[model samples]
Target: MTSTPTRSSDTTSSEYDSDDTNQSVHSDDTSSEDIEEVDEVVDNVAQGDPIWECQMCGALMWYQERKDNSRHSTVPKFQLCCGGGKVKLPLLEQPPQLLQDLLFGNQSPATKNFQTNIRTYNAMFSFTSPGMKMDTKINNGKGPPTLRMQGQTCHRVGSLLPLPGDSPKYAQLYIFDTDNEISNRMNSVRTNKDIDEEIVKKLKLMLDQNNVHAKVFRMAMDMLNDVNFQDVKVKLIADRKTDGRIYNKPTVSEVAALVLGDIDSASHRDIIMQGQSGNLQRIDEFHASYLSFQYPLIFPYGEDGYRPSILLRFVDDTDITKKKKLTIMHWLSFRLQRRKGEALTLLCSRKLLQQFSCDGYTMMEAERLNWLRRNQSKLRVGKYRQIAETPTTNNQSGPTLKGKRVVLPSTFVGSKRYMDQLYFDGMAISNDRPDIVARVFKIKFDELMKDLTKRHILGKVLAYMYTIEFQKRGLPHAHILVFLHPTSKYPTPADIDKIISAEIPDPKIHNELYNLVRSHMIHGVIP
Candidate 1:
């Protein structure tokens, strides 16, 4: 998740830190089993044989052919290291140039020095060389592309049939095809449109000066929208900045109720919703505890990633103080230790967050005992119920109350589901691909701008904002807010008709245009 400002009161709070920057939690202890195994294998392998090692944790491996060739498998099975990262093998020999450089220490120093000084020395020695004339007729690359921004004049991609009295359609297509010229032009336009730099500058100024008024927030938000969309809207209003409010802070459930319904009368609901909500809700106590171990949601006292915003999803009965203790103690005992391969496997598997929470509650119990022992002198008689109430049984048996604590599931599932349904989420092209969806949106936006500029539409664009969101079914759609140029703004019914249409086009009169419009432009019943 991107970093946002933490509550100002949290800066001095013993419960949580406000200024955590690191995202990753590394293991404090290293496993010795892999090291021993690798050392034993290393002693057996011949000196010149090829060996591969994991880059993450220094685990080594070797390829070995299986004897079961009759099974029809032709590939050798690789023995991977404990680190579970991509394997990289060392090059057996250095390159010729590197070897020469190391042995002779760079013999071309004089040549390098001469080349460096030659340009200036030659300028003094030769007259014409210093005052050489250059051709001024050559085209210096500048200005917008050859294609007009007007939609009517701009040719579509790959329309390559010859015209009757002019250049072939192929030639027109060739201009866009050469070296991906169209893509380059689109990229240039996108760069010019990007207002992130301006937004960041203004945002920093507003934050630093404590001038984050409602209008300032709206201005920053407006920068995220397009300038050529039909309609714009903002939701989820914030009345005031909640930066430093800690003592009088509202709980997550309270805030949710305030936003979603009447806060005074709102009742606690299950974190996970069932049925049509399609949420994995109503998690049992055991499952919730197990989840808490993995995610640190229940006892997130010392967890750097923990935020007050996360607790809003839980039921009212959850013991916040106890949860905090568990989270802190869990981290304290283990200190994030794990087998690298196992950790990775758990991270990527169906169980997503399994490693952090351990089996049984022995470690947690031990931690609690240690704390009780240390604080015995400070404790008021029968003050804390956890220790005072049924003290002997609670301490000995290890927190067996099934419903005593509840954990909410991570938001990862719903988020991934939404992204998976999207037609373009950047990940559609490749694992590492970025901005694919954004690029598609920008291209279509540019086309809209082109149409508006040429007066093919009723009004000129002044400014606008747009947002693309994925539906539950995984399709991507855009919501646009258009700001029209005042001079060309349409106020009458006839003026609106110039750009908006409801009836289907006449196939005979419109022909190709009719077919294109009918095929793509129809909307379903509004209600």
Candidate 2:
């Protein structure tokens, strides 16, 4: 590794390790070239410069410059928390960009996008026109009425608002754009705190009850899968559907008996068989796979016109465990059924019904767990170093914080398709409904993939994985990963740039495009 300077104040900076979890001391293994590099670093520090070392791990080192020691000087003396002064240290290497963003805030030195590379455009226009008049017609109730205004002219009421035809002087003006309007709206914090507290109180009670329900549901399903209770599934389905005096609804105790007892419970089977049109109609065919009972936790159950939850089933037994198949089933279910269309209603086993009898998860905890699992292995900083050896960004990390250079890490990884979906959601708003964003994301993503396929940007899309995430400001963003045909991989910067842009577009020729570029694409200076 070549020597690269680091900030003297960054105490967190340390030697790069292959694995973050492994904290054992490094072995005294050194190549001749590494020893020479260490010697050179020692020679530079021995001249008079000081160095910083980790308080917890004394192995890592960072070089620091000597500051004035006179009482009158403003410069502070360098010291380590472990009660040690700067000392000559062996060579150390820099960390990855991902780590740098984590240790410090995200800093972009090489890329122009990090800085304000484009100027924000401001324009002002008014409908007012000079030397213009509006003619007033008699109010006979025959045609539309016309009125005159001092500063502007009016044509027919239904015609598009036209600008003045004559040449006029112009002046630059600044006004809030659509994006600024949304930002302003987001900035307005709701004054009432009690509403949130009450909501939390209700939510907590709901989650606790749901957890109890989920445990019961899981237990019931397990019991139904038992060999002795082969016909129990049919009884449960019949019990749910039957609603007359001759046939009785299964009580919770009877349901418990069916789950806890053995011997097939002939009475339960009779009740189910007689309730149905046929006596013994393919009982095994009615049994659902254990995986078919999956139910997603939903909140504000009252507003959802259908039952609070559903006993989700797949198209076939083979698709039961496949998450994608389940997702597609749900998508179609809603698109066909919930959208005021016809949907085939299958008999849900009583065991599956019991699982959703109560709500079962805290939205906050569920969201947290889901996010943790989703991004557990996403790209992150391993090591990072500053681009220049000028003044340290932090006062604690002083000058002479030099170290060996390391490779820059990837900017993003995981799923590109999901990220694109998220970008599109942020750009568009529809019907003032929050839940719609999820559907919109899926729709837009499909269209985007289809368009990309037509252009052969990445060749035929083989498969894709995606997730929807909500922003703090209440907008949904999508994260997706696409698998493409081997021949369609983006191999070079030029090939990638054909589909993506890093720089601002020229405003003179591409006025409309420039507005979009400035509003969304630009990444401002890192704080």
User: TM-score: which candidate is best?
Assistant: 2
Give lDDT tens digits, candidate 1, residues 244-313: 1122122232221112112233122212111112112221222212222123111221112112221211
Candidate 2 lDDT, 384-480, residue by residue in tens: 2233233445656545756633222222223454576666655655435566766777798778767665555567777777787776556666687
Give the range where candidate 1 is weakest over 10 consecutive residues by summed lDDT.
123-132
- Estimated TM-score for each candidate: 0.15, 0.17
Ten contiguous residues minimizing lDDT sum, candidate 2:
118-127
Backbone collision tally, model 1: 13
Note the Cα lDDT for every prediction shown.
0.31, 0.31
